[model samples]
Target: MTEKALTIITQREDLPQLFGKRIENQAAIEEIISKIEFESRSITFDIETKDGQATCRSLAAKIASAKSALDKAGKAKKDEYTVTTKLIDADRNLAKSRLQALQDEIRQPLTELEQREAQRKAQHEANLAALGFVNIQAHDHVGSDLVKERIVFLENTVIDDSWEEYKSQALEVKDNALRILRPELERVKKREDEQAELARLRAEQAQREQQEREERIAREATAKAKADAERQAQQIAQESERKEREAKEREARLIAEKESAELRAKQQAEDAAKREREAIEAERLEAERLEAKRQANKKHRDAIFIAAKDDLVAGGVDEEVAKQVIKLIHENKISNVTIKF
Candidate 1:
């Protein structure tokens, strides 16, 4: 025969005791999630598909329905967290506001009463300060111990059963102290004012003297500068006049030299012309004398030649030989000649 198979099943309650509480808590959380999912499914819209193009009205209605569902889901999911947070915060803030209001109601009047008491005390102290109560000593009749007692009483006064009585007593003491010290303070103030006035007058006098001295020095400096400027102007004028005179003299000398040079050049040119003319005249006269002497010599020579020729012919020589001898003499071919008879 085949053996029968046995399977063992473990129940949650039969599991270890330590896991029971955790399992129970997980079950509770799952149940809450299931309920939330059920509600979400109930509100959700199912979109349908059509084969052809959808009509505008149907499409718009579907879009509107989908958007509304999305918005509602988002809001609901947000509220799931925000609702608890808002409740806790509101309860905490409301409790705190109520406690604060109660505290303020109790503290405001007490604070105002304390502030008024402080103001009264400050005024009282200010009155004492005005009288110089702390600075100036009381007279011999009003002892220091009594003054200390009065200050203590004013400081301790409050808005209580005996505030009016203590305040009046303190004011009376302050009045008596002021009455004793006012005359002495006034006398001291008058003496200080007189001394201050005298000092101010002396300072003004010194300042005036210093200002006058500075003005005098400045005037002297200005006068010296003016005098120096005048002297410099005079010197400049003298130098300029000298320069002008020298310039004129140099110009005159240059003009005279130029005229002298021109005159000398003209004389040289005239002398050269005169010398050239004299040389030409002397040359002409020399030529005329040479020509006159040449003509006289030629005439004497011709007469001599004629006389010799006649002697030769008269001596019975051949007429042609005589003529030939005369031609030789005329031509100077014979240096010396004797005619034979």
Candidate 2:
């Protein structure tokens, strides 16, 4: 509403002949865009005003129509060009195939020669590589043994016509590789020798240090043992006086105990002898008493046996037979006829 609400009413007469057609009119489209841009400046869209909103709707409708028409036109043109593009591509591909075949046929011998030479060159390169020609820096830190192997391989390589036109190149490569590798091998050998010598020196130093350490330890131990022995001797000397006194006291006490023990032993021996004499006298008296009892028993037993034998003789038994019967009863040879003694 700052300006007056305005609209541009475009008709078909204002457009180019190809404006919504299958052809693109660059100049005409540019003119149409110029005209719209100039007219759009006048049409200020103010949504707060009815007339401004109406003008904005009309311009939007116009732009939408133009956009639709342009899209349809592009589609129409593309649809028509599709067949022509396909035909051109088919002819281009066929010509490409035929021309490629002819070119291949024409260059067949050259191609074969080129391939053979390429293979030959590849073999030469492989041989050179085997001789350690490439990546020489990779061996800068390698060991002497590997470097010697490379030198040996380079020296062993036969440089002859079998290498073909590259024979001289192969020789040069071999020579250069050997030139680099030989010095490297020597350097490596020198370095290894230095390393071995260094290690030997270190080992000898370590052995010397170890021996020194052992000797120091042994000296320390000897000193410690001597100190301990001195201390133990001092302690033994300190204890010797007390031990001597105690030993003398113990010997005197043992002597007193021995004298008392001897006295007790002599008294015990006399008591044992008296007890033995009393036992023998008692035993002799008991033997005499036992003998008297045995004599009395024998006399009673004889009297009983004689009385019984006389009764048997009176009962008409023979004298010798009665004697035998009495003897049998007296000796307890007859059952149930023992005389009580």
User: Considering only N, C-alpha and C atoms within 3 Å, which residue pairs clash in candidate 1?
Assistant: none
1-341 per-residue lDDT for model 2 (tens digits): 11222232234433334444433545545554565566666566778999878888877876676666555655666766788999999999999999999999999999999999898888878876676553543655668877777677777778888877878777788878877877777778888899899999999999999999999999999999999999999999979988998999999999999999999999999999999999999999999999998999888888887888899999999999999988888777999887655
Give a tens-digit lDDT track for model 1, residues 245-298.
Answer: 999999999999999999999999999999999999989998898888888877
TM-score of each: 0.33, 0.40
Q: Give the TM-score of candidate 1.
A: 0.33
- Leading candidate by lDDT: 2
Q: Over all chains combined, what TM-score does candidate 2 have? A: 0.40
Error of 1 at 194 (Å): 8.4
Off by over 4 Å in 1: 1-82, 102-115, 125-237, 240-244, 260-341
